[model samples]
Target: ISSHVHYSGTREDRSSRVVETIEFTTDRGQTVRANPVVSDTGTVDRSGMSVTVLHDRDRPERFIAPQNGHGISARVPVMRIGFGLLFLVVIGIIVNGGRMILGQLPFF
Candidate 1:
């Protein structure tokens, strides 16, 4: 991303206009190159990984994958901690309000 500004004239009557450009360029050269050009670089192979599965008739049982449980039960203790802090804040507010109206501290 780039911006170019052109200023015409001196301080009293100066005027400027900005030209901005935002782009993506793959290759750079002295001259602008046009696309749709093909080269004779042999063959472009785009084949990726291949997976094969074989079944045997003599096997009595297939493989069983181990189960990975979710994080809900593990996160319950953290939620309980946050709830305990919130309850403490509410109780402190109630105690302070009662002490303010009663004209004395809640606990001496």
Candidate 2:
């Protein structure tokens, strides 16, 4: 299994941090993409870029791209969980959204 990283460009995330959009080819020959907001390495332009990444054994899409001996902040996963909870709550509300809004009985 071989792995590699490709740096496309940078974008300012909501946190005002400049993040690099990278795509990596997994050992399974599947390409996974990630945006790492913090990198210890100076920077890599389109000219060429490379970095090492460790992925989940069961889910390759979840990975970490460490730069210059530093890994990205761990709070990211916490945020993902929060968003997932919010999504579920929204779906629950929508299940009987009309009833809830109209103050109807037997809200599902």
Q: RMSD to native for every prediction?
A: 23.2, 11.0
Give the TM-score of each candidate: 0.30, 0.38
Off by over 4 Å in 2: 1-15, 36-47, 69-108
Q: Candidate 2: lDDT of 91?
A: 88
lDDT value for model 2: 0.61
Query: Residue by residue across 1-108, what tens digits does model 1's lDDT show?
Result: 233565789999998654322222222312221211211111222123121212122331221111121111334568889999999999999999987878874655
Weakest 10 consecutive residues of candidate 1 by summed lDDT = 63-72
On a 0 to 1 TM-score scale, where does candidate 1 land against the true structure? 0.30
Instruction: State the C-alpha lDDT per candidate.
Output: 0.38, 0.61
lDDT of 1: 0.38
